[model samples]
Target chain A: MHNKTVAELSKGLAAGSFSSVELTQHFLTRIAQQDPALNSFITVCNDEALADAKAADAKIASGSASPWTGIPFAHKDIFCTQGVKTSCGSKMLDNFIPPYDSTVTRNFKQQGAVCLGKTNMDEFAMGSSNESSYYGRVVNPWGENLVPGGSSGGSAAAVAARLTPAATATDTGGSIRQPAALCGVTGLKPTYGRVSRYGMIAFASSLDQGGPIARTAEDAAMMLNVMASYDDKDSTCIERDVPDYTSTLNNSIEGLNIGLPKEFFSDHLNANMQQQVENAVKELEKLGANIKEITLPHTELSVPAYYVIAPAECSANLSRFDGVRYGHRCADPKDLEDLYCRSRTEGFGDEVKRRIMVGAYALSAGYYDAYYRKAQQVRRLIKNDFTAAFNDVDLIVGPTSPTPAFGFNSKGDDPVKMYLEDIFTISTNLAGLPGMSIPGGMIDNLPVGLQLIGNYFDEARLLNVSHQFQQATDWHTKTPKGFE
Target chain B: MSIKREDAENIARLAKLQISDEQLEKITGDLSNILSLVDQLKAANTQDIEPMAHPMDAVQRLRPDHITETDNREAFQKIAPATEEGLYLVPKVIE
Candidate 1:
């Protein structure tokens, strides 16, 4: 039962082989036993999960169940869950219990999916490693010493360990893909505005987009169907109809042109990891896809531009967390200024403060033209590069991360070295394109991810490409030693 | 591109975060390192390029001005640190 994909689980529920209560209990028990080692979950809603599961059982009995009805899935702590603590992996909101559901949570509820709990993440979605989380770092299921790539690390780790069949996650710069690469799971980030950001906490508004991390591309597509929708509450949610992503998973890829950026395989990438990705490409070619060498000329500038733009937006978004409203407040204050300063300093973690300070500096009086405006200009060039490349290629293929998961604490002190972990996945977010990370193979007993970047709103094609490759390879099926 | 201790202090003040002397020294070094890394953006030529604030050129969607939300202040204020008589309590801002 634990090994089944989401489709299989839904089938079982429909067949009366097991009730939703039984399935939810199975996962809850596994989490109780296995999660002590991984620390992937921030809060477990035991009573709420059982109640939702019981409700799902009622829906199943009524013969009106959707594919997701009675399915148990985890939500990253970033999404606000009504009456449950949505911590965002930060102490600032540890005591917060959202009075209302975020649009994402509301959608899952409408479809009758059971919420298992909120998963841990980096503080405010700021770091590539989960070490910055106030709840403590999440350990990689493959090796306890290695860091789970973040700020979606907990969701990726849980899916890989089979704690849940699937979980909701977000990508800002490479939050979803990088973690999925390290944990050996399937993850996707849709085009910006394709999903609503109404209730999810903001990190960088333009770069942040919500998607899913699951065991297979088909499973991810199923989750995406429920997650993507337009909401008036979120002004940026695109007013476009979403197609059924699963409808095209079996589409033929014969003569499909895939661009391989030379820059993606350069010295920044590890030699052995390169071999694994190349092997994955070979498998795709055998499935009748055509591979071509291409160039995204301004690839190196993405990191620098992202650093400036993300922080500048974050600084403005986070200003609402003053001592007066909802969130942590200082114990004693000398005045209003002290109240604001002390509360924020006490509430946020080091990484959050570092970003806030950097953001403030970037948008400061004298530095605006040199840093913020210049980064935006460079961003245009990066987007243009993708626009030019997509004219000839149906999709872009590359390694998701330069290397497999690094050991925990390896890059903690050096922020710049840590930023480089996202070198491959950032440009897609900058250009507001859809991207997915599928398991390629293993290197040094760790997993490597093959990334697929599609033209705007071309998620169906991306899912089809991923599903086809998954059929020819078994990388996504491999599980960690102890967890399996 | 090196950030000074005083610069970090000023940034912290502007960002509304309190910093200790110890935090000031460490933050200065970290800020300097990050800024230096971002300084690589100077290599790109953008004399005639247009700046992109959003990924897509989206304009703010405006609806007819009307009452769209029912007041939920009571439910929202339940999580406030200090509230009194349906109003958020804050340090004195008036004389």
Candidate 2:
């Protein structure tokens, strides 16, 4: 199972070549030694992981096993695990252990996959950079001075640095893809409602969806197989059947029509990013794929509409954490107002509170129709633009982010500058389509990512294309200079 | 449309956040920049546009309103600041 994909690992486990405890121990050693400087993990459940691994071994011995049995994976901290600390990267939840497992976590555990630990994230999934975590900023495992893109930085960094085979991550806006791009890993955000969010901490709920991150698309496909399910617990969960994602890996991309949106190549895009993505497309062309320029005219308006809509939803969702129920509370309060003011002020980071205020203002009594309603209308137009593009192309390709990973203090003192990093990624969420980021090319040695977007419920096709690319190039297999 | 300091603070209060006097000034400037960008969305003609909240207009696939979910109120409430008689406790405002 050492050099094998998750499919191979599962086959070997079923065939009794390697026990679950042995597999879990190898990863634990790597994480213990490597995660200290990377700060990828906030909590490593060493004892619990071993116990789960032993149980998985027993299940396999009793002839009760599945493809996910004995697979070791880490979960993002935002998902609540029963009896495990579920801090969504805030001091408010730093000590808060949950009594219930999130639907995603429970699904993996039911399949007998051992949870290694909770990975770090941007506080409440609000930051474009990993620096917003309450624990401390996570550094890109590629370079010491570079920042790992966020708010799923921990999951990306852990996978890229070989601390874990794969990890579970959520995207609201570009939390999953941006970090996956910056840290040089593979991540997919399934179509909205494709995964259950029952135990996930609320963050821009309308845009949030969870998927997998790993070194290669094949590993991601296997994890996606287990992660996707129709859950009755989450009202938004899709009723569609989950497909065998790995079944399509051998499908050829010959004559596959790929759309390159003109708006993605606007002057606002950094020249270097555009060049690297072009190179990646050229490589795909060599593999028999046909690339075509398509128009997604409403792309430019996505950022503005997203900022307004996302924050507006955030304001309503975050109202639950009033310090009276289940989060941090002020030391002393003379009234309920004082209690709320002090608790929220002390509880949230700058960016989260900034969004809450923006959301509240947009949704306020007078501005609701003007700002919030208008934003929703534009969101529909954005989704329509994508629908129009799919009529001509099987997948849409572009730079996952505008540029490569930035320095530790890059984009500092300017929030808008940081928000632009998610420009290309946000529209996919707006359109409610599946999106994946694959290791594309390098800019000044830091990895850049190429994004592939599929029509709704087209995750299997997206995975097939990414797997073909990984098989052709050694980019996904190459680790950073120092990390290895 | 640069935001005024008073307007910024007013919004802050409405949002229930405490911004210090000095923080209000910086926040005012920041809000101005963001709003200037956000204002661009209003230029599009969307009179006939329908507001979309989801991909489909189908009825929500809700679980039967039965007690499929248990209230581990005692377990969950262990993390709350105050709980009494199975209800979350808070300051009384209508004394």
TM-score of 2: 0.97
Tell me the tens digit of each residue's lDDT in model 1 across A401-429: 99999998898586889999999999999
Flag regions of model 2 displaced more than 4 Å. Answer: A1-4, B92-94
Query: After TM-score superposition, what is the CA distance of residue A124 in candidate 2 from its true location, in Å?
Result: 0.6
Give, for candidate 2 chain A, the lowest lDDT window spanning 10 residues. A1-10
Interface C-alpha RMSD after superposing true interface residues, each candidate, one decimal: 0.9, 1.4
- Which whole-number lDDT from 0 to 100 does residue A49 have in model 2? 96
Give the per-residue lDDT digits (tens) of candidate 2, residues A40-91.
Answer: 9999999999999999999999999988889889999999999889899988
Number of the top lDDT candidate: 1
Chain A TM-score values for every predicted structure, listed in order = 0.99, 0.97
